[model samples]
Target: MRSAVQIADARANKPGHQIYAGRARAIIERASIALRSSTWVPIATGFIEPVLYLLAFGYGMGTLIGDISTSAGSIDYTVFIAPGLLATSAMNGAIYDSTWNVFFKLNESKLYQGMLATPLGPLDVALGEIIWALFRGLSYSIAFMLITAPLGLVPSWSALLAIPAAVLIAFGFASFGMAITSYFKTYQQMGLIQIVLLPMFLFSGSLYPISVYPDWLEFTIKLLPTWHGIELIRDIWFGVIDFSSFSHLIYFLVMIVLGLFFTTRRLRDLFMR
Candidate 1:
């Protein structure tokens, strides 16, 4: 009887209740507002910047820079850089949605508190928020593919796979970003993420090949999941898909799982305090 009571207490304290409909619904509603208000603005805004980079830099200046050799073989500088941008876009959009949006609601709106009153828990909140990010990430992804389609950038019907790839990328970033959020007390805290993320984007071979990076810099960049994601997307876009795709797939998968584990644990701690 004591063990049973202790188990029940533990369960009640942990927010691990099954069927968290209320929490899911609330998260969906919040996400819906972002979608309805922004409409295509998010897609257009996110895609245009990268497209412009492709135009002015890829086709324009990349043409002057000429073809570059990759282990994936020789390709235009634009072709090489375009897919890396896709990875960054996926990371950027999802991180923005998860970290700040989740942070504000968790720390400020007391959104989770209200939901917990109805049987929802921190894991539900974390998972639901990630779902929202995935939905938005897919939209941006489809828009990105549509925009790039005319450029003949897609390498296969499997190119359709990129949309879900973006979602996976989003999950990895969003889960980890939300994990980081539990430690934050204010918006100023996120400046460090921005600082870290920007340099990762700039230096992780998104704009330039990592091969061009010095050996030490190259080693550190490769250690990041974003680099693996960038490489995966690039291979698909450039028609280089092979058995090694599984490694990248595993990279993002492990990242999402690990991140979620930490995020939920952290959120639980924050709420307890």
Candidate 2:
């Protein structure tokens, strides 16, 4: 009953559709091996930095700042900052894995070069690295949330939504980070990443509300991927669901698409050529 055009289209797409199947699995297996070799100490240690910030700023600085006002209503200063920390945790974890770990594998280790010798292609490597980064970032976000829960920072059941939101934030950052790192030929270039990331972390309404910024600056901050990420987690933590929350989701989704496009293109250029 199918038309000739439909049959032709299906036949044309078949080979391309199979490209991701076994190849992506092979790349993920490579990631699993790397994960098994990694030490738990460093992973555990990463949790400490964010917790320290939460305690120092939440409790120490909270004494002076007291409660803060948000769209969700008035909240303890510590609680107000918790979701922002979660966003930062996701960003930090993803960027570290995608940039440093990926650069090491690509350049010094020549891991991806070996990967290309197999049935896998550039897209598989790109996707596998991204998945691994998301896994690491999500782990950090979950640990931070667990630490926050006992402190009475998470008031709403909606805090559960934060897991997926954190994953999305991590995905956007990891993909974007990998795409950017593909252009770097030296370790010294990694320092430049901090120049971009630090400002986004500090000024993206993470420590304070965007309303306090100048009109132009506030508009610029809102356009940042991290700012949208922070707002998404904050809104979920406070149980504030609305159109803006969906808009934040859309922003990260766009980042993921553009990032993947660039990453796959760059990887092919680097490894396949």
Candidate 3:
């Protein structure tokens, strides 16, 4: 009798849960359109910058630095920087998706306004856009890793885990960028994210180890999510797994949750206006 009653309750609760799905599906469907394009140009563009870094720094500067020390031990400078590049790639790709692409749709293109005219609400648009951005970041990560393969950079199985690690980092920052976007009214403000994030990308050990910086700077940079993500990927790629790896993973996850929380609230407020 209890099992029968529980089944009845579950069935009764299902409809209420399914109520908003139509709006969600519409938003996802709209975002997927640009993704399906033959747009080889964008893909080519993403690869060039990372490839330049790998060639210029990985080969050119590897001579000066040689093998660098880590918790595991010293590995090739190329190896150390490989994961940082991966993390930066993920970070930059996600920020672009969330900021420029989002702003264009929201303001210049008026696409979001059109979507708002439909059943889709701001929350639906924001959620779908973030999900779509995650998809883009994932695509870029796999391609970048494959490009890095012949360089003999991927060290082991844990190295493969960097791809998903990249995904999580991208999602967290992308959502955070989206949240920041809700607060801004113009492109002038958007440039600050680029200016700030680019410097963080360069200084966060994407090209060199963090200890190369002075003690104070090291302490400060370590607090940034990019630092944690870069360190985590560097550890995995170089086989330096430890408790700190778990800590880094937790940090990015927390960032993701926090970003989502603020972004949802901001979107709710924005569309209500």
Give the TM-scores of the predictions, in the order they appear.
Answer: 0.85, 0.91, 0.87
lDDT of each: 0.75, 0.84, 0.76
Candidate number with greatest lDDT:
2
Instruction: Output the lDDT of residue 243, model 3.
Output: 90
Backbone collision count in every prediction? 0, 0, 0
Candidate 2 worst ten-residue window by lDDT: 13-22
List ranges where model 1 is wrong by over 4 Å.
1-26, 37-44
- Which is the better candidate, 2 or 3, if ranked by TM-score? 2
In model 2, which regions exceed 4 Å deviation? 1-22
Instruction: Please provide, for model 1 over 94-132, each residue's C-alpha lDDT reduced to its tens digit, 9 standing for 90 to 100.
Output: 876787777788888987677655555667777888878
Rank by TM-score, descending? 2, 3, 1
Candidate 2 lDDT at 182 equals 85
Q: Write the per-residue lDDT of candidate 2 for residues 88-153, one digit (tens) a residue.
A: 888888887899888898889888888776555577788888978888889889999998998898
